[model samples]
Structure formats: structure tokens, C-alpha cells
Target: MNAVEIQTHARKLYDAHGTKALAEAAQMVRELEQRGEKKLVEDWRRIQSALQQMRGPNVS
Candidate 1:
């Protein structure tokens, strides 16, 4: 799949399963890494970082 497709799938998986989805997404990223898909991995890292920020403790 292309970057967009991988991103969309990752987002949906993240929403549906929270961090539990990371295993699958990370697997995809690892495959992409092996295939030299740098941009896609960068985008995936951004998405993962965003999700982690969203789940951070609230300061109030």
C-alpha cells in the first residue's frame, strides 16, 4: 500500500484499539523501513507522536 493508505489504516486502527494498535502499525513501519520507504516511516512517526500527545496526562 501507499503512504496515504498506510496512514489511513494506522489512524483507524489507533482509534479502534488505542496503543494496542501500535504493534501492527509498527510492523508496517518496520517493513517500510526495510524497503527504504523513509518518507512513509516519517509520516507514521508523526502520527504516532500526535496520538501519544493526545493521550498524555491533562494538566488542567
Candidate 2:
């Protein structure tokens, strides 16, 4: 899949599974980085950062 597709899938997974999905997404992103897919890796990072922001200070 393309970067956008990967990102979309990651977001869906994150929404469905929460923190476990985030961890899996991170691993997927790392694998993409290892494979030299920089754009996809960056997209995943963006998704991850967005998720973090959503959690804010109230999250434990």
C-alpha cells in the first residue's frame, strides 16, 4: 500500500484498539523506516503525534 493507505489503516487501527494499536502502529512505522520508506514513516509519526495530542494531560 501507499503512504496514505498505510496512514489510513493505522488511524483505523488506532481508533479501534487504542494504546495497543498505537504500539503496533509504531512498530509498523519503524519497519517502514528500516525498509527505507521515509514518507510513510513520517506519516505514521504524524498519526502518532496527533494521537498523543488528543490524549492531552488528562490521560493516564
Which candidate should be chosen as best, given lDDT against the real structure?
Answer: 2
What lDDT tens digits, residue by residue, belong to model 2 across residues 1-60? 555765676668778988787677688788999999997888787777656555566745
Where in model 1 is the C-alpha error above 4 Å? Answer: 1-11, 57-60
lDDT (Cα) of model 2: 0.73
**TM-scores for every predicted model:** 0.59, 0.66
Backbone clash count for every predicted candidate, in the order shown? 0, 0
Name every residue pair that clashes in candidate 2: none
lDDT of 1 by residue, 1-60 (tens): 555665676678788988677666667678889999998888776656555555677678
**How does model 1 fare in lDDT?**
0.70
